[model samples]
Target: MELGLVGRTNAGKTALFNLITGSTAEVAPYPFTTREALRGRAEVPDPRIDAIADIQDIPRRVRAQVQVVDIPGLAAGAGQGEGLGGKALGELRQMDALIHVVRSFANNEVAHPEDAINPLGDAEAIDIELLLADREQIERRLEKVRKSAKSGDATAKGEQGLLELLVTEIDQGNPLRIVGDAEALALGIGMGLLTAKPVLYVINSDDPGEPLPELVAYATSRDAHVSQLAVGTELELAQLSPEDAAELAQEMELGDVRGADAMVRAAYELLDLVTFFTGSGPPEARAWPIQRGLSADKAAGKIHSDMERGFIRAEVVAWDALVAAGSFSKARESAQVRMEGKDYIVQEGDVMQIRFAV
Candidate 1:
């Protein structure tokens, strides 16, 4: 999963990205500090994978990963290419989901682009810019579809109706995603409409452990999830070992969890992705991310193309069952394994041992 980090200038986005990926990207107290996207791989944390590895005495353990991209800041009039937001917005179109960073902490040295500390207003402004950009893009495409329809193109003519309806919704201040039917939703995805991506708000807090009631309320109203992270504290935590960090966290009275973990975990869940595993005795134990309703054949394709192409069957067992029985042979001995075919739907926490032909 590619998660695009976006927000206004000086929103501490780079700081959060650095903390999560342990990358030393240049972070300055200025707008548009990130002109291009800086990407780093984040190994997603999962306890179940650890259990599987320990129980199986696996030689190696590989966790799921997400590609984190820090996008440039957006500004007012960005939809019309203001402050190079248009260019940055283009990068965002490729992201699987969006992490919107909102600056709420007041730092004397770090000046706000808007000269104030209103996170709600900043979030709303970015939302409108994305909405306007989508509208502009769809309107331009709709014109071409119309021209093609006039040329007696049947496919173009059929698409023209849907395009017209989308434009009307966009002009009425509704995003193509929200106002769209299943077809429109698919169309909007093809068009790379900015508003179509799922969003998770990250509020850079003034202090630790505070959820910022007002910001939480705002995100709640929009049916979005919010993570209150103390960027400074998280940066500190990132510099220490896990054991040391836990000790310091206790002494400093940080929140119930580390900010860095909370931010990434929240973003992961926001994308509605599920985790499954592959179990064999020696080579490795790994976790794979898939959509909720993925089928066995399709899920096999995620591991390798040959697995999908030569798919014979799958031996599926719950991760816990495998762990409790201590091995695949033990699970089979206990009748805990389910034999599923290509059409079978894969479930979360499933430990799969695939059978295939050469």
Candidate 2:
């Protein structure tokens, strides 16, 4: 899963990225500092994988990695090629989900691009910008489709009609994500509409301890997820040793300093993704991310195409069940391990063994 961090200038986007990825990306209190997208892998937290690995005596390794891209901050005229706007918007197009970091903190030293700290207003502004970008994209594509429609091509006419409806819906302030069924909506997939992607709002607070109700309400209204974190504090936490960080967190009354975990989990959920594990061998149990509701065969493909092609049956065990049974043999004896067919839905935290002909 790839998640992009985006927001207006000085909205703590890079700070959040650094916090999550432990990356040393140059985060300054200004716009356009991160000119290129910074890529890093984040390990997903799963205790079952740890327990299984421990029982199997596997060496620890990072499991369930998600790629995080910290793109340059976007501005008002970004869609029109202003102030790295084109590059930023282009980066956003590649992301599976967006983490829109809104500035909820008030700091006179670090000036907000809009000269205010209203997260709701900032989120709305960003939405409008995305909508405008999508509108322009639709219009441009519609021009070509219109010519094809004039040719009396049946497929072209059908596609043109869909585009017209999409335009109408978008003009009515509806995002393309909320439009219709994925099959019907696949007609406009090539258009690269900005509003088509799922988004999660992150309220960047100056005080690491405080929560913003306004931002929470805004996210709820849109049915979008919200995360709150003091980017600067997280950055500091990232610089410390794990033990030191825990001690500091205790001092600050921060429950668990796994802000990165929350951020990554939210990103995964926003993208409708789930994780499955492979191997009971040492060197850490491996975890792979797949789209939710994927079939056993498809989940095997995520590991290796060879596995998919040679797939016979999958020996699956739920994480908790396996942990409770204490061993794979025990789990199998207790009927916790079940043989799943190719079409079986892959559940999150499932430990799977592919029985292949080859």
Top candidate on lDDT is 1
Q: Rate the local accuracy (lDDT) of all candidates.
A: 0.85, 0.79
TM-scores, all models, native as reference: 0.90, 0.90
Tens-digit per-residue lDDT, 161-220, candidate 1: 877777777677665546547887788878888877778889988686667788788776
Off by more than 4 A, model 2: 54-61, 181-184, 188-190, 208-211, 281-283, 293-298, 304-306, 309-312, 341-343
Q: Model 2 over residues 44-137: C-alpha lDDT tens digits?
A: 6766678878776778755677788998877887766667877778888878778898888898888787677788888888877777777777
User: What's every prediction's RMSD, in angstroms?
Assistant: 2.5, 2.5
